[model samples]
Target chain A: MTDRLEAQFAFLNEADRLKSVLRATTLCDASRPENSGEHSWHLALYALVLADQAGPGVNIDRVIRMLLLHDLVEIDVGDVPIHSQNGTAHGSAETQAAEARAAERIFGLLPGDLRDDLRALWEEFEAAETPDAVFAKSLDRVQPVMQNLACGGGTWATYDVTFDQLESRVGVKIARGAPRLWDWVRCKVRPWFG
Target chain B: MTDRLEAQFAFLNEADRLKSVLRATTLCDASRPENSGEHSWHLALYALVLADQAGPGVNIDRVIRMLLLHDLVEIDVGDVPIHSQNGTAHGSAETQAAEARAAERIFGLLPGDLRDDLRALWEEFEAAETPDAVFAKSLDRVQPVMQNLACGGGTWATYDVTFDQLESRVGVKIARGAPRLWDWVRCKVRPWFG
Candidate 1:
């Protein structure tokens, strides 16, 4: 019992480091760069509040779970802003590899059953195959774009993220999850890169 | 179409403010004050990761929803800290009333159906009724105590919180949600207040 309790605490304590993993985009109010912890919370809220925007047969509860766990790996790999100078996901191949390893060490803090369950969920989001994953991935992409536009082109300006670049990176996944929102966002952000 | 998008954007923008509403508790890392947004995220993770601690038949999904939306009202009423100077919930009747009104206005930012759904969830948590709310409230009580212990009495030391006071306030609720955890935590934190 003592051993098991200690294991859970270890994971929760490690989660504190997430608040320090800064992203590229600033808060919409432009205070400072939002951390992964806060970003996940906002994304979960989007999952709840924007359930209507999701396609038919999408399971909102499952989508919320994916969003909550998605960027947790950022705690270990660290976050590379969507529009970093490199403009890559979690930085690059090296960081991606780091994230994969971090996912193990971090989620491994759980008991065996939970570790397996969460690792599968994390992989599900990465594959973006299921309806839930598609929706969660779309919300993940949607948040930074909103932050950029709300901050008057936050990361977009910093990274020189052009429309073509933006569309290629986020367009397909965003369309898959919520086509109408993807279309509307395109019109809203067209001038940022131009 | 624009109207719906506008409503969502407005709500999302408002949520950014939650990141600024810092709580009395420090991160287990003892870095800076943890903001309500990040704290809520941590709590949701607790809901998912610690669901086993909850009693049988408790809906983990519903509990997670309750945790996610719980502190959002603090954007309006602001946080009073579980172990604040007064060592009370929101400090005063006036403050509690303010939080109630805040819950309505904050959750009301969603489109009609979502607004009602979320407002109800927020209220359910406050009432602490049903299996889900009881389980959610338990996780809520559990996090801060763990934070204080991990930080070697972070906020507990500053506030000079005594064991009796802590027990009187949070003991029963914590026991109700996860009895084994509560029992372990009591032994873990007894030294802090003693």
Candidate 2:
């Protein structure tokens, strides 16, 4: 029992590094770029506030869990912005390989059952195939777009993001599980890009 | 549908204020005092990482949801640290009233259903009655103790906290739902206090 508790604490202590792992998107207040830890929290709040718009059969409870766990890998690889490297690294095989290894090393800090449970959730999120994972991914994409829109094209202007890129990279994934939210984002995004 | 989506976005945008709401506890690295946003995120992560310690009948999914929503009232009332104001405001009647009003206004930013759903989760956390709420509240108290332990008595040194105060104010609550965690904390905390 002591060993189990110590292992759990070790995993959590490692997670603290997430606070120092900054993301590219600026806060809505435009104060500073948000850290991965807070961004994941905001995304969980998005899961709660916007669960109504999730794809049918999405278990919002599970969706919320996925959002909280999804970004833990960024603690190891740092964030690869969707537009960086022409967004190639965003889903490249190499990046995926690095993240999978990070998952093992980090989640491996816990005892067997927990490591498996958390790693499985992380894997499910990466797959983005289940209804819950689909909705989780949709929110993951939509949040940055909303943050950009709020701060007057926050990262969009930073990356000189174009409408075509937004459509191909962000819009389609969000539309997969949350058509209504995607529609709203599209209307808001058009003015900024135009 | 458009109106509902807009309302959700408005609530989310308003929630951006949380990142600015600072708390007394510093980050584990002692870089700066942690803000309520990331603190809540850390607590949610704690819920995920330490779930094995939860009390019987504790539904960890709801516990995670409750933790995410718990401190949001801080966005309105600001954080009343457990050691501040003789710790009176931590759960004082006036504080409860202020937090209740804050809950209505903040959670109210969402449309009716989402608003009610989130507000109830927040209330469950405040009441701390059910097994899930009990475990959630245990984590809510334990995190700061762990943080203080990590950073060489982060807040305890600030407030000149005493062992009796730690026992009365913090330890009992954690033990209620997670006795094992309290046992672990007691050991680590003893060396500092002694």
Candidate 3:
């Protein structure tokens, strides 16, 4: 095979690792925690179905790409739930440090151009600044909440996630994506939370 | 919620069905068969890592989107393995008829505009005519072959798939997308087959 195909195959083979990286969120059936592979897959579909919810004029393609690449770092660092609460910002410094390294290593396995492009997509998902990013973030936060609600308060029951923590961590982003889903979920879920 | 978000949510909720739709190909480890969800996920990542192999000037985004939506119809119709020959084409006429109906029903859950757009993407994947479609088809063919090789001739051993059968069935599409990988696999896997 060609050199580029070899590099591509290597990267593709490495991606199988994501299937084994389990998350804290249980499946809607509560049979097992969903792996990063299926979560990212489900998130990409969520981006597709919910693109309109991401505010007017957002680029759905970019958001879909962002969702596809988002949890790849979890292949390296494992999933850190939104409620991990390390007494720090979005994630603990140690976790962020680990993910950044994981991103570099995993994405670097691709040839330079593809590697740069994918790494850029991962960064875009992390920055959550662009219209696409904001919308992607909205759906990202929404999935687990929907899963939790779907399965009679999935992981949240274990975490005992309070209304305030959920509001600050998830609702803030939902409000940007679709104020309606935000309002709807709050009414549905807050009663279950402490 | 607005009508669009409601439609989107209903569609998103329904996407969980994909996780249960089993495909014929096993995971790389051959421990169990793969689901459409994670297979789609792996294929999207394959599009990213193998974008360069699609030759110059292909739309990587379109290819990625196609792969993501490809098997969604399987959620309704269930997976049809490439080797499920009943003296017809890739799949039986009944299977194709069922899939078309399934596609319409599942995608119809989305708001009209998004539903039409996604159904178009799914058809593009099915047609595999455009440059993006060709590349997407190419990777789709490559994935199961790679998985079989990874797991020491996974399903091929079970079915006793021959070199000639694989050549006609899979290699035709494989040649279009990545010929080198195709040529390499022929030499490597022909020994496993009769």
Candidate 4:
């Protein structure tokens, strides 16, 4: 038991490797940038507090799980911002391959049941057909918007972003997942545009 | 506008510094391991999934918020493992002082309403009087146990922990926040003890 415990600790110790990879990939305020761990944590909280606001009857727990594990694959494939016009092309295959490797290495540290459960949750999130996935993606999109607003147009300024681009990035998810939040964003951005 | 944006970006960027401080303080499993970001994210998800199991009338949103922000102060005072023999010896004055500093630095970044809201949530969580705080703490305590069980006695083996120690650390919160979960733990751990 002690020897097995030691072996497990070695893997847990490398958990920071996930953080390191996240830090390398994500941008903090769209401009300044942040690590993946912070992004994951913040999104998890969003999934929790705002779950009720999700399209009715969404399973928030599953959404939270999805949010936490979603970017973890970035540990290998690296973060590819959904809004990156130029960077989006041809990245999915490589990213998918990287994520598969990351899921195996990271989730493998846990006992069998947990490994399977978490890995399945990660896969479910990627598929994004269920209520949980939709809500999780909504949280993911909203988090960056909140950061951008708080940071005074973080990515908007950095990318010379137009209202059209912002709308396109966030509109669909917000409309589908949390219309109230979408309304809030629309109201909030209108003043800036004017 | 640029000046305001830069200021906000600086605030968001400081999240890295906070992450570093939390990494230094909290244990990943039990024996002073894993980064703080992981702990925060894990607990948030735990709160989300277990919301249905919380004592009757518990506000799931508030509980989730508390779980997310409770440890942000670890950014300043660092993680004080409740199970540690040293925990009882630590004075509240040190923790309070650190919390004050952390609250100011971290929450000050957001615009007015958000800053106040998050800061208040953090303080409320620390006070632990509200139902949200109680359930939040329960989830916090339970997450490590789940992780340990998954990783085959994570901190229990590393620290040579006893059943008594585990109970002393987690008992009260479990009793108040989620009695059923406590019962489940007892059932699982009883065999290990034998």
Candidate 5:
């Protein structure tokens, strides 16, 4: 029991490091770059607030869980912004491999059952295979766009992101899980992109 | 549908303000004061990581949900630190009433059903009634202590907090829902307070 409790505390302490892991997207207020921890929280809220707009069969609860656990890998690999370097490394084989290794070491800090469960959830999110993961991924994309739009093309301006690039890189994934949300975001961001 | 979507977006955008609402507790690294948003997120992670330590019958999913919604009111009324002003205003009647009003106005921005659902969750967290709420409240108190411990008395030193005050103000509630966690935390934080 003592060992197990120590392991959990160690994992939680390591998780605290995530608060210092900055992302490419700044806060909408443009004060500073949002950390992965808060970004994950905001995305979970997005899952709850926008659950109605999700694709059919999506489990909002699971979507929320996925969102909460999704970017934890960023603690290890660092955030690979979707628009960074023309979006080449965002879903690159190298990045995915790094994130998988990160998931193992980080989640492995927990006891056996928890390590397996969280690793699976992180994998489900990486795969983006199920309805829950799809919806979670959609919000994952939707949030940065919303942030960028709110901050006057935050990362877009910094990265010199083009409309075509956004469409191919971010729009399709968001649309795949929540078409109406994509439509709403499209209308809001199109003017800036053009 | 458009109105509903707009309402959701408005509420979420307003929630963006929460990221700006700072709390008394600093980050573990002592970099800056943690915002209510990330603080809430860290608490949610604590709920997940420490579920085994919670009282029997605590539902972690509900605990996570409560943590996520619990601090949105800070966007309006601002964070009233538990140890602030010698812990007088933390749960003062004026603060409770103000938070109730804040909850109504903030959650009310959502469409009817979601507004009720989230508002009710927020109230449940505030009331700390059910097993889940009890567990959620426990994590709320636990995270700050952990942060303070990690940061060399982050809030305790800032507030000149004492051992007796911490036990009465924070320790009892944490013990109620997670006695083992409280035990571990007590061992860690006792020296700092002394």
Candidate 6:
């Protein structure tokens, strides 16, 4: 019993390293440099709050699971911002490959059934198929927008984000998944543009 | 335009700081050292995957919203673990007061309507009176169990958890909110005790 307890502690110690990795990643909302963990939380919220806004018959639970585990790979691969077109152009493939390896190791700490369940959820999220994945992706895009708006143009100005670019990257997702929120964004941005 | 952008960025910056605070305070698995951000993310997933398991007629979206914002206050008050009862005994009132202040300053970054909308969500989560809160709290408890089980008894062994204590903490909530998962947990733990 004592040995089992010690082994569990050792696994948790390793999981702590993953937290550090996530803390290093930043999001589109520069005001709130998101750790990977926080990003998961926000995405989960998106799955819930916007579940109704998704297409009819979408499964909210699957979307939530995807959001939570999608970035677990980031623990090893390191975070690559979805918007950083250039960031991915270089060593992203290698980074992602490494991340997959790490994810397997980290998740393997769990009992077998759970390990499979989480790994499957992670894959489902990456595939972004079915209603759940689509909704999860939509939330991923929207969370940063809230951060950006809250932070007063956050990375937009720092990164020299043009109106068109912002719309293309973030607006398009909102339009599809949560039209009401997207409409709200359009109204909000009009005055700024003028 | 520049002024509005500046204001927005300022808010994002504060939000970023809050994320940092949360990351520092909470453990990932309750037993493992997880950042508050990750904890939030995990709970969000719990809401999603466990949506069908939630009480009938409960709005999954609202539950998700509650889970996401539930810990935003931790940005100000810092995370107080469920088991760290002593850390919170004297500090909760002070923490609650501080969190309210932080929520105002942080959520205030967005335009009035958005700010109010988010602030209200956070408030509802704190109150935990509605179906959303009950289910949200259930998810909050469940995620740590999944993490602990994944990490091989995580804090359970570290805290010297007895089977009864663990069951009491998790069983009631799961039984009420997610009977199927609770049943699964019972099955999983039976062998451990034997």
State the iRMSD of every prediction, in order shown.
1.0, 1.0, 1.4, 6.7, 1.0, 6.7
Put down candidate 5 lDDT per residue, A1-194, tens digits, no spaces: 78898888788888888888999999888988999989989998998899889877888888887788888888889999888887888889999899888998999999998898888988999898898998899899999998888888899999998998898899999999999889888988899966
Task: Estimate, for each residue in B71-142, the C-alpha lDDT of model 3 and write its tens digit.
Answer: 888877888888765224456778888889998998999889989999999988887778788889888888
Superposed model 2: Cα runs more than 4 Å off: none
Q: What share of the true interface contacts does candidate 3 keep?
A: 0.62
| Each prediction's TM-score versus the true structure | 0.95, 0.97, 0.91, 0.60, 0.97, 0.58
**Stronger candidate by TM-score (1 vs 6):** 1
Per-residue lDDT of B1-194 in model 6, one digit per residue for the tens? 33443444444445444355533223533543666666665566555445556787688767766666677666667776544542244236866788889788777875565568779988887776777777787777666675666556665665566777767766777666666667766676656555
For candidate 4, the per-residue lDDT at B9 reads 39
What's the CA error at residue A94 for candidate 3, in Å?
0.7
Candidate 1 per-residue lDDT, tens place, B36-139, comes to 99999999988888887889889999999899888988898778877775576654787778988997787777777778888888888888878899989888
Task: List residue ranges in candidate 5 displaced over 4 A.
Answer: none
**Clashing residue pairs, backbone N/CA/C < 3 A, model 4:** A22-A36, A27-A33, A27-A34, A28-A33, A28-A34, B27-B33, B28-B33, B28-B34
Better of 4 and 6 by DockQ: 6
Residue range with the least summed lDDT across 10 consecutive positions in model 3 chain B:
B83-92
User: CA lDDT of B151 in candidate 3?
Assistant: 83
Q: What proportion of the true contacts does each candidate reproduce?
A: 0.67, 0.63, 0.62, 0.24, 0.51, 0.41
DockQ of each: 0.76, 0.75, 0.63, 0.18, 0.71, 0.24
- Looking at model 1 chain B, report the run of 10 residues with the lowest lDDT sum: B82-91
* Ranked by DockQ, top first: 1, 2, 5, 3, 6, 4
Residues B62-134 of candidate 5: C-alpha lDDT, one tens digit per residue: 8888999999999989999998898898989999999999998999999999999999999888898889998
Model 2, A1-194: lDDT tens per residue? 88988898888878877888888898997889989888999999999888778767889888888888888888889998899877787889989998998999999999999899989998999998899999999999999998988888888888888999999999999999998788888998898887
Highest lDDT model number = 5
Residue A109 CA displacement from its true place in model 1, Å: 1.2
Best by DockQ, which number?
A: 1
Q: Model 4 residue A166 lDDT?
A: 70
DockQ of 4: 0.18
Cα error, candidate 1, residue A187 (Å): 1.8
